[model samples]
Structures are given as C-alpha cells and as structure tokens.
Target: MKTLIVEDSATLCAIYSQYLDGSGLEVTSVETLADAKAALVDWHPHLVLLDIELPDGNGLDLLNETVNLSSPPAVVVMTGHGEAHAEQAIQLGAADFLTKPFDASRLRVTLLNAAEKLTLSQQVETLAVKREYLGPLMGSSSAMQSVYETVESLAGTLATAFIMGESGTGKELAARAIHQLSARAPGPFIVVDCASLATDQLERALFGTDGEVAQGLVAQAAEGTLFLDEVCSLGFASQATLLRLIQHGTYRPVGSAAEATADVRIIASTNRDPLFEMREGRLREDLYYRLHVVPLRMPAMRERSDDILMLAKDFLDRIAHEEEKDAHNLSDPGAQALRGYSWPGNVRQLENTMRQLLLTSTSTEIDESAIHQVISVNEISVGNAMRSRPSQLAESAMEPSTIQPLWMTEKKTIEEAIAACDGSINRAAQYLEVAPSTIYRKLQSWKAQNLNV
Candidate 1:
C-alpha cells in the first residue's frame, strides 16, 4: 500500500518513513499542509496518515475536502494534541484516528486494515458502474446505431413500446438494453413468453393465483420493464387482461378479489404481424394501440447487411475467450460467405454458427469450408422452415391458386417485403426493384383496403 505521512515535525516524519518503509510499504513524507495538498492532488495515496496539527493550517481543513471530493482516498488522521481533535478528525471521514507517539506495531496494523477497506470500496464502485449498463449490443452500422439511440432516448420515458422482429433478432436483448438505460434500471426486468406458456399457465404466470396473492406480470414488473415476447400468441382472456392493465394500470389475480395497480413499462415483441393479428381480432385493436405507442421495428439481418461480419467476429471472439483459447480469425472466403448468405435467423443464427465452428474446428483460422459446414444454405432453409408457424405457411400457400393481376401481386409482394424487413420502406423498395415513392403509394392503397375490410 502507498502511504502518505503528513507530519510537520521532521523527526516524526523521518521515523514514520523509516518504520513504514521497513514494513514493505511505499512511503512519502510531507512536513507542511501545503505539500500534503500537493501530494494529494498529484499522487493519490491509498492511505493518508495525516497529522492534525500542521505548520500552516490544521489537517482538519483537508478532511472536509477529501471526504467531499469525487474518488476520495481513505484518511487515517493522527494528532499530537487532545482527544477533542482526535474525535473531530474521526467525525470528518477518517477511516481510523491515531494519537501521536503511537507504537509502530499498532500503526502498521491500522494502515493495513484501512488499505483493505479502500481496496474493497474501489472494487464495489467499479462493479456498480459496470452493472449500470447491460451487455454490449455490438454494431456500429447506421441501422444498428439508430436502434441503440432509439432505445437510449426512450429508456427514460414510462411508455409502452412494441418491438417487432423475426426470431433470433435479439428482442429480449433489446428489451434489456432499454431497461439498463432506463431510470428504473434497478428494478426487476421480468420476461414472459406468451408462445411458450399454455393459456392457463400464462394466466397464472401473469396474474398470480388466488391462494398466493399472485403478483401478475405487470405487478411483478412494477416500476420497471415487462418484456412480453410473442405477444400475438397470448390467449384471448390473457389479451383482455393485459389490455385492461395497459389501459387502466389495474388488474386482479386470476381468482382474487383484490384489485392491484400496475406501474410498469410494457415492452412487447412478436415475430408475426401484430396488425394481422389485430385484423383477425386475435389481438385486440385497443391493446395494439396501447402497446404500440412507440413501436420499434427491429430490422432483420438482411436489412442490416453491413453488420453481418462484424457481429460474427464479435461472437467468435466471445466464444474463444469463454473457452480460454486464442481467438480464431475469419478468412476472406469465410467472411465473404457470411455476408453473401442470408441470415434468416439474424444475430442469433450467427452466434450459434460461431460457437459451432469453435467447437468443431481444430485450426486457428476459420475457412469458408468450415463456415459452409456449419452454416449451409439447406441448414438455414431448415431453420426457416421450423420457425414458420402452421398458419403462416397456410396463409402463404392458400393465397388464391388463381393468380391476381400482375400489379396486384407485385403490390402484395412489396407489402410482404416491408413486413419481413420490419416496415423499412426503403428496404422494401430495394427488394421490389421500385422507387420509395411507389412503395408509399402501395402502402396507402393497402391502408385503404384495410379500412374497407
């Protein structure tokens, strides 16, 4: 530990220097308060062995400054005067107070104890700063940067936001990023997957049971964020309950008599079109509007194509570090194949592919062949096939065996593209080989038809 002895008496300072030096501690001695202040400003010592009675000023003056300063070092005050001064020093944030003419044995033990406390304090503050932010959402691409900024801007506001993206698009991670940046970051971040739970199970999970005073999903997420994934799959009754909670901020347990208030920021996600669900009346229109206050449409991997290799490298490095092995760099052909192939599963698929390569490959450099083995076109197709809901395939296949007019089919294709890209009109137009204005016109026409429907 680095120790600073602020004693005006030259003899006493020399004695302190000799004793602390022999004890294997780096010691610096200053005879006046001015030199002490200079040392404190320049080299922040781990422990300040301050003498209260300095030549120019009392050490008590520096105590207030030390305690009040940001990143203050610990102080261990010493006095050659009365007990009153010792008590005063302890009151002003002194970790320990020692009287003059103290034995070296006691001073050594006290300084050691003070050093431990200081080390632990620094460690705790570092961890606190780290926990204040969630995991790195690694992407510097304009598309990803926009997503980051949107989450940051909306984090402080207590409004519901709906995030729509395909599976493996990191919806939950996005939700967590929002919460980490939010004012209620210290509160619970509860995630409820509507698609994973049965109707009865979802009901019990969201709105706790009768005998137990169930803290519904909203209640459990009070003053925090509630992430409801695959919200379109929520049963009709649960949808109604969730709608009531969002609208009125009030809900009751499934079988309870007591009504509870919900003060939560609901962030809902779905792979399917919430509008389609609303159109079919499977998802209530009112609930849709309530949760869609600030709809954040997460772009699919194809839309954010620039970030493909960057994300792949990031995941690869993470896996390497986790396995305690040197990082495997991607070859040119490997990178080319990564960017060329469509990541239908988005970021999640890329992460899995990186892990698979790390597990299977023995070489330090990952080549295109290794990548192809892990991320085949057929493998991706199979993944997409598995992700497709029965209704989604049925809707796609049952879209009139009799072909519609070319213009009408083209319009429908653009609409589907827009939905697939999470409402990016520019991407939709690019996918359709048309101008953005044309996409807007088609969207307007679709809206008109929706009104009629």
Candidate 2:
C-alpha cells in the first residue's frame, strides 16, 4: 500500500515515517496542502495520513479533495487542535482521527485498521472485474459486475432484498444466489409466484389454513429464504399480511389465533416499476418500504449486450450436455445476430432461443441462418402478442415528409452494417471505424428523437 503523510513539522514527519517503517507501505511526506495535492495526483497513494493543520492551508481541504478521487485513498486525519476540528474532519470523510499527543501505538493501530478496510474494498473491486459468474447469474459487463458485488455484500446479512426488473431478467436466480451464498445455504429455498395465485390462494399458500397438515411456504422456508416473485401482483390484503410478517417476524395462519415466528429471510421481486405500482395502489407503500431494505435491480439483456454471446454460448453448451447431443459452436455471424437484437425477454428468452436452435439445427456450427430462423419465430410471436393488445400504432407511425435526408443517410448506413452483421453495434462500429460507445450514443439520441433508426 502507498501511504502519504501530510504534516508541516519535519520532526513529527520523521517520527511518523519511522513508526510506519517496514509496515509494507511506501511512504511519501509533504509539508503543505499544495504539495499534498500534487503528491495526491502523481503518487496516487492508497492511504493518507493527513494533518488538520498545514503550513499553506487546513488539511481538511486536502482530505476532502482526496476522498473525491476515482479510487480514493483512506484518509486518517492527524491534528494538534484536539477535539476542536475532529468532528469536522470526520464529516469530510476522514478514515481515522488522531489527537496531536497520540502515541506511536495509537497511530499505527488506526492506520492498520484503515489499511485493512482499503484492502477489503480493493479485493471486492478486483473480484467484480474478474468474476463472470455468480451462482446462476453470468455476465462480465460493468452492470453485472455491480450486481455481483451487491449480491455478495448482501449474502452475509439477513436483510430483506427487493429485486426489480423486467420479466425473465433472472430475479429468481438472484434470489437463489443470495440464499446459496448466505449462512442459510444448508436450508431450503422456497419460491412463491405471486402472479400465479389468486388473493385467497396466495394467502393460503403463504400462511397455511387452520388445521392444515402441510406447512405454508413461509414455514417451509424456515431458517432459509422465501423468494416472492412478482410481488407487485399480490393483492392489498396479502400485502398487508406480508408487511405485518416483515415488521413483526410473525404471521398467523388463516383461522388460527396463535402467531408463528418466521425464521426465514425474505427476498421479494417484481417485474414492474415498484414505485409506479405503489403510487397506483397495486403495491402497498408500507410493504414496499419494509421489503425495500436492499434494492437490487437486475440489468436487462439490452443493457448488457456485451455479455450476449457469452451467455448464448453457455446456454448452448449446457443444453447440449443435457440432451446428450454434440456441442454446437456459435459462428461469428450467429454471434453477431445474437448481439444485435433488443432482447426484451432477457436471459430466459436467450436460453430458449439456444434450445430451439439445438433441437432444429443439424449442423455442428450454428450460423446466422439458424439463429435468424429461431429469432424470427420469436419476433413473429412477439408481434402477434403486440397486435392483439390495444396500441397507439397510428400515432407512432412515421411519415416520409418528417424525415431528414442527412440523418436518414447516416441511419441507413449504420442500419445496413447492423443488418449485415446481424444487428451487432460492435461489428457495425468496426466497419464504420468508430467506437461502439459512439454508435450507442447516436442510437440513443435517435431513439429519443423518435427517428425510427
């Protein structure tokens, strides 16, 4: 670890440097805030021993700046003002504060604690970058990395986590990950599909009726996890009962007078916007707050397009093994097609597409034609479903007179490349000699403008 000591007194600096010697930290000493700022940029220390008072300025100012760095150093504020500015220093993000007359032992212990925290934080970051799979969840994108970190952090605690995402975005999988990684891994993981049951049925299923021989889902999930999928679909009555259970950790079975203690961890999920659902009275506001202790949002497939092919290949390999068929490799064009489409149905849809290809395709290598055959069928099904519903088709229809020539030409070129590569922005960007982010930005702009790109 790199350590920066910001103190004006050369004698004190020498003492502190000697104290930290052989402590495995590369130390750098600066006397003023100006020099400290320069050292912060060039040296990029992992830990900082900051003095509250400096020759040029207050060390709290430097501490504030250091904490705002992209990968900020742990700042231990050292001051001679005793408790006068201790509160202010801490408020500015000081890792530890030491009074002027502190001994070497006090300073070392504080630095060690701060250093330990920094080590753990760096390890979590490293794991996020390298880990491609967390239980059933698999992705290497920045979005998925964040999800992985959150899941890992939540696994050690008994906090209730509310996962919100589009349907088939693997909310259940995330719940399972939390359960499997938690201390309750040895116990059962019970799932309740709130959308599948009626209000009465849901209540009966969750909390057993009087004199029932079989235990309810909550009881079945004792000392484990109870995953409530599509929780927004739960009726108001059921939501109230759930809120009571979460708040009191006790629930009464229908027609029963006694309360049963709940030993299970609650993990709820919904495909709808929870806030919107709450406002519309579809979900209880109180219930939402109680269960929203740790909100985990699953990234949609479109948001993590970079992981499309990786997920596709994993599905293909796993499906082949299950069916006792020869493993199929995704051809470049096939991969391109997989990446291009907006996966509204998310991972579940992707997995289904792979299964369809394996069942129908006889070739060892799955190419663009095979992929398109499966995708087109899916698109047709989706189109049929959309057509059945009332839609603003006329209002959304574009007119030729509204088109801009230059924008149309650019859109056409990009569209052609995307079509040729089976809808991959990365491939199209390569053909256009532009960054993928550049194309993504333009596509977002075009979508916002309703240009139909």
Candidate 3:
C-alpha cells in the first residue's frame, strides 16, 4: 500500500515513521496542507494518514477534496486535541480517525487493515472496467476489438442493425450483446428464426394471428429488440411485410381493422451474403438499406487465429465444470494443433468439438490426437462439399430412376455423414453444412418413425 502521512510536527512525523517501520508499505511524509495537496495531485496514495492541525490549513479540507475526487484515496484523520472529531471525519469519507499521542502498537495494525481494504477495492474496480468490454464475449484479440467498437457505437441507438458473419461465428451472440448494452436492455428481446418460420404462417407469427391480438412476436417485443436470424431465407411476401414494418411504426395483424403501434428495435443476422440476397431479389432493397444503417461483420475464427486457443480453452473449462470432469485445460501441443488447423465451421464447431472431447476423452489434457480427429472430420466435410458439381444436390435429386421422396434422400445422406463421423452429430452437421439443431430435429423425426438415425 502507498500511504501519505500529513503531520506538521517533525517529532510526531518521526514517531509515525517508527510505528510504520518494516510494515512493507511505501510511506511519504508532508508537514503542511499546501505540500500535502501538491503530493495528492500526483502521488495518489491508497491511504492518507492526515493530522487535522496542519501548518496552513485543517486536514479536513484535504479530506473533503479526497472524498470528492473522481478516484479518491482512503483517509484516516488525526487530531492532537480530542477524539470527538473522529465521528465527524468518518461521515466525510475518512476510513477511520485517530487522535494524536497515538498508540504505537495499534498504529501498525490499523494501517495494515486499511491496506487490505484498499487492495480489495481496487480489484473490484478493475473487474468492473474489464466487464464493460468483455462480459459475455471472450478473447482480447484485435479482431474482437473491432467488434467491441461497433457494439459500443450501436448500443445506445435505436438503429436497425444487420450483423453479417459466417454460420457459427457468433452472429446471435453479437445481436444479444447489442440488446444487452442498449437502453432497451430491460425490455423483452424476442428472436424470430426467419429460416424456420413457415411461409404460410410468417405473417401471423410476426404481426399476429386473427383471434389473439398479442400473437405476434413484434407486438410482444414492443419497446425492445426483435432479432431476425437468417433473414435472407424470408420469402418475397414476408420481405414485403417486414419492409412495411420498418418504414412505418405501425403494423396491423392479419384480419385486424386497427393498426397497432410497435416501437421495436430490429437486429438481423445472416450467414449468406446480404448483397447477393438483394441482387437475387430474395431480400428487399429498401429493407436492406434500413437494416444496413449499422452493419457489423464478425470476423471468422480462422481469420482470428489469435483467439483460437483462448476460445478453445474457455469451452473446455466450461464443459468440464458442467460435466463434473477433472479435465481442466488443453495441453500446449493441443493448443498448437488447434491454431494450425483451419476451422471450417468457426466458433460453434470448436465449442461442439470441445464438448465431445470432455465427454469422450478421459485424459485430463486434450491431446493433439483429439484435435486432429476433429479437424480431419471437418476436412472431410469440406472435401465433399467442394467435390459436388455445379447445381450441387439439384442435379442428383432430379434423377428419374430414384423416384423417391426428397426427404428420404436427405435423411440417408445426413445419416451416412453421421455414421462416417463415428456418430458425432456436430461433425456430421459441419459436413452437411447445416445447423446442429437441424440435425437434431431430423434425428427426432426419424426416431418417431422407428427408423435408425
């Protein structure tokens, strides 16, 4: 601890030096209030031991300044007269007060206690500052810095933002971060999965159905954020409805005569290129401009090679805790392998792989073999995706000889990928270029059919 002693009497100051001797604290002494103020301007001691009777001014004056300063130091006031001022000093933000003719034995213990409190207080302040930048997010790389800057800029506004990134690059996380930081953080944040919304029922889901007025996600999300995930998948009719919603603050549900006002902040995300969507007429150009008011492009995992192990280790530790496993971290070789291998599926794939390792590998440290196994599975998926010729699955699906349900073909292909990956659904999902949820839902449907998945 850094302590400043403000005492005018030279003999008393010497006595204080003797009491504080060998206490492992850096001590500085000043005799007058003017010198004390000068020292305070730059010294910024953690604890100030002040004598009320100073040469030029009362120690209470300096105490008041210390209390009101932006980053104030702890104060312990002393007086040669009486102990009555102790109560008054504490009410003015002094940590504690002491009378002159101080007890030498008690002085050491008093300073030590104050030092401990100062240390803990500084630690809490530091944690609060760090959390403002990285509470839900991890990794302190430059790639993440840019994202943080954009998040900060958009957090206080009501602009409709579009977060663009590859699948599993944490687009939803970015959207949630914006909502959590915004002024509307306390209000509801509803996510409408545009890709999953049925075309025939999207209007009802967003605006509302006929009977129930509050059936719409937008109406429910009033005064908060409405997140549209995979918005590029929305059909033209849905796109037109959404454009109208953005252009005007009012939206009328299906079969409703009155138009209800919905004050909502829109945040949308898509893995597909938004420009391509506009060019192909999938996404309305006017709606694109509205959402493009604030554009956030998340850096892919491979692009942020600096954050690979950081993210990997974080996932490992969390998985270990949840599963009650003793595996604490990744080995140096494992970390190196992770950085070297190209992550075709980004953060989500890495997280899923870590979960798999914690569940399957008994070794405390995730070794290089586990890393290679996961990467090799992803590599196979990329190879298969690349080898599929132009028109991709369309060319094969239209074969007259097959004459089978398209879903059966898709199920067979997905199952083969899972079997090939030795029953790892995450790796299979990566190979099939779909969300893990899609794979899980498909397996559930197959299970209902009494068919092996």
Candidate 4:
C-alpha cells in the first residue's frame, strides 16, 4: 500500500520512517498540507498518516477535504491533543487516531489493520467487476456487473430495497435474488402487484380484511419478504398505510381496531421513475423516502449489448428444453442482428423472440433472415397496436415516408452520445455500449468518406 506521512516534525518523520521500514509500505513524507495535497494528486496514496498540527493549517481541514475525494485515502490522524481532536478526526472519516508519545508497535498495528481493511475493500470491488450473473439475472457488461454487486450487498442487510427498471427488465427477478441470498431465504417470498389490484382492494390485499378469515400478503410474507411490484401505482391511502407499516412494523387489517406486528422485509419495485412519480403526486414523498433505502436500477437491455448473445443462447437453451425442441445455435449474422436491435421490452422480450424463432424455424441454426422475420413481425404488431391508440395518432403523423440509411442513423446516435458526454470518446462508448476503438474507427471511416462527422 502507498502511505503518505503528513508530519511537519523532522525528528518524528525519521522515527516514523524507521518504524515503517521493511513494512512493505511505499512511503512519502510531506511537511505541509499543500504539499500533502499535491502528493495526493500525483502519487495517489492508498493511506495517509496525518498530523493535526501542520505549519500552514490544522490537518483536520485536510481530513475534511480527503472525505470528498472520489476514492479517498484511508487517514490515520496522529496528534498530541487526542482528547480534543480525536472525535473530530474520526467524524471526518479517519481510519484511526494516534496520540503523540505512543509506541512504535501501536502505530504499526493500527496501520496494519487499516491496510488490511483497504485490501479487503479493493478485493470485493474487483470481485464485483468480475461477476457475470446474479440469480436469474445474467449479464457480464459493466452495467449488469454493478447491479449484481448492489444486489449481493443488499442481501447481507435487512434494509428496504427499491428496484426501478422498465417493464420486462427482470425487476422481480432482482428482488428474488436479494431474498434468496438474504438471511430470510428459508421464509416465504410473497409478491403483491399494486398495479393489478384496485385502489380500494390494495390495502386489504396487503394488510388483510378483518371480516375475512384469510390474512393478506403482509401476513403471508411474515418473517420473509413482501415484494411490492409497481409500488408507485398504489393509491394515496394505500401508500400512507404502507408507510405506517414500514415505519412501525405494525399494520391494522381493514375493519380491525387492533394492530398486528409485521415481520416482513419490504422490497418495492416500480417501472416508473420514483422521483417523477413523487413530483406528479402519484407516489407519496415520505413513503418513497422510507422505501428508497437500498436503491437498485436494473439497466435496460440496450445498455448492455455486450451480454446480448450470451443471454440469447441461455434463453434459447432453456426455452427449447421446456418446449421439447432440438437444441439450436444462432448463426453469426443472427447473433449480430440480436445485438444491434434496441430491445424496448428488455430481457423478457428477447426471451419471447427466441421462443418464437425456435417454434417457427425448422433449421438447426437460426439465421439472420429468420431473426429479422421474427423481429419485423413484432415491430409490425406493435406499430399496428400503437396506430390504433388515439394518443399515438399525433406521433404517427410526424413519421417520415423514407427510412434513413443505417450508417446515417448510427452516425447521428454516436455523435449525440459524444456531445452528451462533453466530447469524451470513452464515456460516449460506454453510453453507446460499444468499445472506444469502435467509435474511433467509425469516426475515421466517416472522415475518409468525406462525410460530415
């Protein structure tokens, strides 16, 4: 680990240097806060051994600044005024505090413990990046990897989780993964679809009706997880009741004068943006805050194009087995087509498309033509249905008669992404789900063609 010592005392610096000698720390010494800040930028140390009294300013000021870094170094504050500044240093996120006149053995032990913590944190992060699947969700793209890590972390706690994603993006699957990995894994996992129930019925469905002998989902999910699917769709009254349940862990059944204790862990999900719903007064702000403890956003399929073929093959294998069909592989062109299309319906739609292909195509290898046929049929069906809706008539009126060339569409999309990222090719590539090299090559090709890039 890289260690930065911010002690202004020359005698103490030499002594501390001797103490950490052969301790496997790449150490650098600075006498002032300004020099320490410069070393932080240039050397990027993993840990900082800071002294409270520097020649220029209080080292606590520097501690506060380090707290705001993107990846702040672990700080060990050393001082003579331990009683006065120890709490303040810790509050500013110091890993450990040491008083002057302390033994070298004490300093070494504290630093070693802090170093071990930093190493474990880095290992967890690296493991999260390498993970490709979490329960039913499968994707190796950075976006999905992040989701996997969050879900895994949430599993280790009882904090309420709020999952947000478009329809068919496997929001429920993510919730299931958390429950399965949690301590409540052996308990019942109940799903309550707030969107499907009537506003009046939702309260009773969740908290039970006093007159009825049957308990509601909250009771059914006792000692387990209650997944509130499309939670934003609940009525204001239901939202208020749910909020009460979350706050007090107690709920009153409809027509009941007594309250019942709930042992359920709430995992709420919504297809709509919770903030937007709050602003529009559809979702209560207080209720939103109560349930937004551990938020997880499942990325749309188009955002993780890197995992398209892998997911396609997995879906195909599972679906074919279920349907008693022969195993089939996607041709190279078919895989390319699958990756190119924007899946508005996300993973659910992709699985459906694969099923359709398996049932209709007789060939062992699904080719580009077959894939296109299935996708085109789906698009036509969606277009026809959309055209029938009165709300879409205005949008249909603006449709162009001729479709733009694929290259022109690609150029517009790539350029817009680059502009959105402030001309950062790497950021644009991430947003576009393509490699930076791909963007560079495309820009070069467009330039070579004398096309406006």
The digit string of per-residue lDDT tens for model 2 on 1-453 reads 899998999998999999988778888899989999999899899999988778788888888798789999999988777686888888888877888888878888999899999899889887656678999889989889899989998898999999989988899999999999999999999999888888688778988877871478988988899998888887766677788888999888888888888898999999899887664445666787898899999999999998999999999899999999998998898889999989889999999999999988989799999888888988999899988886564566867686567878888888899999998988886666554656676677789999973
Candidate 1 lDDT over residue span 1-453, tens digit each: 778888888998888777675676788889898898888889887788998888899898888878876778789998778788888888888998887778888888888888889999999886444212234566656667668767877786888878888998888888888888888899999999888887678767877877664356767787788899889887666676678877887777778788877777888999989887775445766778888888777788998888888788888898999988888989999899899988887898889888989888899899999989887755877979987757754777855666566667766677689899999987775555444655676567778777321
Show model 3 residue runs off by greater than 4 Å.
1-133, 381-453
The TM-score-based order of candidates, best leading, equals 2, 4, 3, 1
Worst 10 contiguous positions by lDDT, candidate 4 = 392-401
lDDT per residue for candidate 3 within 1-453, as digits (tens), equals 788999998887888988888998788899999999988998988888998877798889999899777878888888767767788788888887777666877888778887787788889887545322444667677788788889888897888899999998998888889999999998999999999886667888888866776879988898899999998888766776788888897788889888888889999999989887674445666777887888999999988888888788788888888988885678888888889877768999889888887887867878899878866776787789977756745756767675767668778998899999999997886665454566787778788998742
Comparison by lDDT, 3 against 4, better one: 4
How many clashes does the backbone of model 2 have?
1
Listed per model in order, the count of residue pairs whose N, CA or C atoms clash below 3 Å is 3, 1, 0, 0
Model 4 off-target regions past 4 Å?
1-129, 211-214, 391-453
**Ten consecutive residues with minimal summed lDDT in candidate 3?**
127-136
Clashing pairs in 2: 340-423
Query: What is the Cα-based lDDT of residue 446 in candidate 3?
Result: 81
Candidate 2 whole-model C-alpha lDDT, 0 to 1: 0.86
TM-score of 3: 0.59
Candidate 4 local lDDT, residue 350: 95
Residue 388, candidate 4: C-alpha displacement in angstroms:
1.5
